[model samples]
Target: MNQTDTPDKSDLSSISQAAGKDNACGTNSGTHLSRRGFLKRSATASAGILIVPSFVVSGLGHTAPSDRLNIAGVGVGGRGFSVLQAMENDANIVALCDVDWRYAQRCFDHFPNARKYWDWRVMYEEMLNDIDAVVVATSDHTHAAVAAYAMSLGKHVYVEKPLTHTVYESRLLTRLAAEYRVATQMGNQGASDEGVNLMVEWIRNGEIGEVTHVEAFTDRPIWPQGINTPKDAMPVPDTLNWDLFIGPARMRPYHEIYTPWNFRGFWDFGTGALGDMACHIVHPAFKALELGYPDRVQGSSTLLLQDSAPMAQKVALFYPQRDSSFGRLPAVRLDWYDGGLQPLRPEGWPDGRNMNHRGGGVLFHGTKDTLVCGCYGADPWLLSGRVPSVPQHERRVATNHQLDWIRACKESPDSRTETKSAFHEAGPFNETVVMGVLAVRLQALNKELHWDGENMRFTNISADEELTIIMEEGFSITDGRPSFSRPRTEPINAQAFAEGLIRTQYRSGWSLPPMPA
Candidate 1:
């Protein structure tokens, strides 16, 4: 990773000055830091980490574990609680923030000294200067907003995966981390697994020859989806901030389906099965294959619903040839199966061996042999032989994932504290996974969606223009060119497509922090 990428003036100019829409929590009283000139100041403030990390108390030669960071937590419920537990031992956790106090209370109890807030915007505003780092483990939709604001405050961030709800948001965070020179780590723990490095070594050493295809699957959607919204609104629980829970998504009446662990199935609120699990299954495949973006993507599902994801869906993405030591690699096709779906059993497996364990697994089919492993890249081995001996190049994590990021924030930069899943790699890897989410959304059309990764536009938008795609519900994409003049390359404006999907529109007062141009 490049340690230097100062934000340009133009990037600063684009960030809106309007108080963000989500800062509605009334208790959010604190000094308002100026977003303008913020980037320049952050670059300078980062240098202060070396001078005095506030909480830093060093003895001879190096800082002790007791001299740790003052970190803040957003979404301290469920998985958010787990992340807090993982890092609390090493850091001075200063604040706990969550939308629902009921679910977030356990974490609050764990850290009696920590301040509490339901709105993360409030927490950041009230304690901006005091915090050395931020940890975001919110639902998929709000991840960008919270982390973006935290990074803007010059705090190192560790975001849970899949990093963002949209490809555009992932790209923004990737660029922002580098520009701020803030250490970042995505919460896909397997990126730090020694087994993942072993897999990378085997693939690079051609133990599996050239991988032509990969089939990864998970039995998720253990939540409700492909369903209608509640016909009537439920009374908002006094302990929950329904508006903040909805965050930047367009508002709707509060319902049980949208909260308390079921939100993963909703389109507006969560990222369904694909978003919830693929980041884990695809983590090692991404790093080992050196995948950036798929050249083409398509999907098929039971059906896509307006308010929720399909009951089941499978997406196939093709990544074309790229350079490798194995010489020119052929197009690698990856297929994702979900919601109790499983891929066809591979060839060359021993007569009675199971292809995968119960939860899910990833299989790499190469010309010479096949490799498989459980999720989070665990227990990887050859189909019927001892693990191949290959030289390892990537460094293994010394303690665990979360501690690595925590230590990297204060511990020596030259040491083993550097995280393997830093945003530079995780951002692009996650952007790749969310593409599958988009494909699953379009699966009802039963069409192959062509992607122009460089332009970040769906090349096949023209196909939809040329053919009438009618939904069973009633809406129709009619067969005709767009009224506005298209691009010269038989094109549509990339910026226009970007505005709606790659990054979505924030509700009235909310805006994502802009990245340097």
Candidate 2:
């Protein structure tokens, strides 16, 4: 993974382009009626100058223009497309933007009335006054920049999971959401699920006693990782704007390996298996246990790579005891696994039965009993084969993640209903999740790195701590026997390396927008 000490200082204001020059599509009439125009006409009709249909005035059969949000979607080719589809019933899908038009064509076809654009900046430039909210599902590296710009405009935003690429970016978005007072939600769909709420209720009610340890695992990296960067550049797709796709990260030649879903494995573009899945898998634990931050973390992996994450990794995060209104909470340990790794099966599980419903699940070993939950915290059950029933504590919301955010967006700012995974909460949860990423990346440090969450620093190790980094061979069958290799070692300042990864440097012309005054 590449790390930079100082970020580029240039701001987005410096990147300018002509608006209305490259719009891909618009209304069927060949003339655009902006939201401002609709409001003006509605105002005129109220004065008896025009007669509006009863349905339009009362929103009996259709939503009134005044009652619907004009929403825009960025990176609408994949996950964003699904989000917009969910919001269509509640809001007006007014605009769609993506770097690759071919990839986003399906979304555009579904909402033919929504204007299309290759660049989000241009979409915002042309329709800033018309938009009420934004749905951002851009690549991990660009989530911060996109969400920050939207929040700065005071537009409610729904962003996809992992929340952000780096710890610094997650922290920045959390602050921006509050500063702008925008209703914000991160797309961890399971956060809104009844199963997750039940887990929280059960754990908080002490149905399982105190959770002493947790094992969260996933089968991810469904894409390539633990390999050297592709050396040869591939031709850029005709419909793709490569520069826009690279947003905020250092520019590189276009390659099929880095886009359309494969980016998850690359450090610069994505956050690997942990970031992709942990937001859903660990959310229940974070909520039920009030896991604020881990004081110490350590990790081991199949093989650490320079340009990407390892194929498999096991990370342990240690949290300190805490005092709460109900009582004092004991310190807990969280172990995370990914890339085809899983925790041991509960003792009473059938010999040949699967450990988890799918490739991932969470196991909570408490003082009194053990509980296990499937991915997304679904299908939780105690070791004795019973789903705990506890008093409902968490307020439930719309089961659809995007719809929940839409409800939050429509709320009055002064009395907003917080989304289940609001930025303020998801942001901190994300920081905790990505700390495992940091541990995995710095596995060579081979030290239990102590963290100071509030200060965003490592407390135990000095920046100048020198050490010999060694690479161990991964396990494989060779001629029906074990294999080995002479380990390669290098000397470096380990603590400094760990610190650089906590944050990331932005490429020129791609800084996160500053908070609004």
Candidate 3:
């Protein structure tokens, strides 16, 4: 992990006028202060030599820090840029931080007045006093690291979906949020959608009858997968800080094939299709049926790559019977498909009708009727074409996902609003999502793998069974195509292998804070 990134000197031109300008929080704009400068300022204020702004002390007639949050964005490129834009109306944009300045230039241009930093750690250190919340939209591998550090400092965090790269990190972040007692939300915007609420309400009203099984599918992996690691070393771009992008993952040579949007296909950086889409597609099933954790998980995929996810895969998660408010819900099975796969279409379904025009959907096979919805739980309906009218019991949010989080951050202690995908819920839910990823990685077990959710391990596995997988790898380009390798076996420990993947190892200088005692 490289920690040598410094602030852009060109962005410091506004430091002289920072104190004169008023921000949305009704406080003076903040400048990037060095450690010595920050300490001196703190000492001066403590000695009562600094004049405090009226609004900082009280709201009076203006919006105070109490009314609006001072928000900073860590990966203000791509999705992070959009998240910050959505939040700009409600919060003060105090700072913008990103590892790659070239990619994040659009955000920098858009929020010109906001302080900019190349590294998030420096941003946090310099602007800790000014920032009230952080929006983290970094690669999946670093989500936990960035958010955990922010939460440790009592900063509210909104992280992008597929919360963490590993199941253990999900559990860690969830617990840390509670220990810190700060408002936190995962960036699964669909969780706050009207569609998810409707799906939950319909299921609660028993409109779907008893959901015997559920199937969710998506046409993801828009990026390349089922391939070997790129051996072609490329020069790191001048505008990018390559080490920061790698974060906690082991350092690898820079390659265009691994960056921008393509990281989703890689194992070390992203969680492939399951992690990319399940959080959106399977959310309704989890919410509507209260699918907490699966007792058993199994998967099969196309040739498992050396350093990336397969091109396509299918995973089955078996849940045991659990008591619910209505009664003991029957044990259910959820089958997930990605990379252009779909479940056997429902019987008697019209061929002319598309399953989901959006290329992804969820199907709840109830004893009486089959309920289905598109991506993000949109347009939920029954296959019988007779959707029942259920009284809406779920709270509806008029604001978008980002604003909902902002609203929660501004909530007074007397009345706190929990964001739809608050970490307490999103964390456990993410553990389930990444478990599917784990099953994909360990498909070599070649049997239905038993999962002990409470213990966070796979039970019923024997050491007698060798853990080597037969992989047909393509490492070189031959005649304009990838040359293939014959099936080869590599030995591995089935039990320890599963455990190691569950809890990812961090490179030095990038460790998660220990769970609070």
Tell me, by lDDT, which candidate is best.
3
**RMSD versus native structure for model 1:** 9.6
Superposed model 3: Cα runs more than 4 Å off? 1-66, 463-465, 469-472, 475-483, 486-489
Candidate maximizing TM-score: 3
lDDT of 2: 0.76
The estimated TM-scores of all candidates read 0.82, 0.83, 0.86
Count of backbone clashes, every candidate in sequence: 2, 1, 0
Worst 10 residues of 3 by lDDT: 22-31
Q: Kindly give the stretch of ten consecutive residues in candidate 2 with the minimal lDDT sum.
A: 1-10
lDDT of 1 by residue, 1-517 (tens): 0101121322221111233422335222211232223334444544444223222322211566567788888888888889878887778898877777677777877887787765666565557666888888888889998887677666789999879999888988988776666778999887788778889889888898888899999888788977755768888766676767877899899877688878888877778888888888878788888877898898878756556787888889999989864467778899999888988876666687765564679999988888898888888988758679877787888888998887677654335345889888888888888898888765544578888876677876643242222222333345763343211123334335433667788775456766656
Any residue pairs clashing in model 2, and if so which?
1-306
Q: What does candidate 3's lDDT look like per residue over 1-517, in tens digits?
A: 1112322433322222234421111111222223334445444543445523322332212434347778889888789999999988777897988777777888988887888776676566667668878999888998998888777766789999889999999988999787666678888888888889988988888887898799999989798888777778998776666777887899999998987878999989999999988988998888778878899999889888657899999999988998876677989999999988998898967778888646589999998889889988888888888868878878898989889887777654335668899988899899999999988888877788888887788887786655775454645787898776656567877777788789988876556667654
TM-score of 1: 0.82
Per-candidate Cα lDDT values, in order, are: 0.73, 0.76, 0.78
Off by over 4 Å in 1: 1-66, 324-327, 351-353, 411-417, 444-446, 463-499
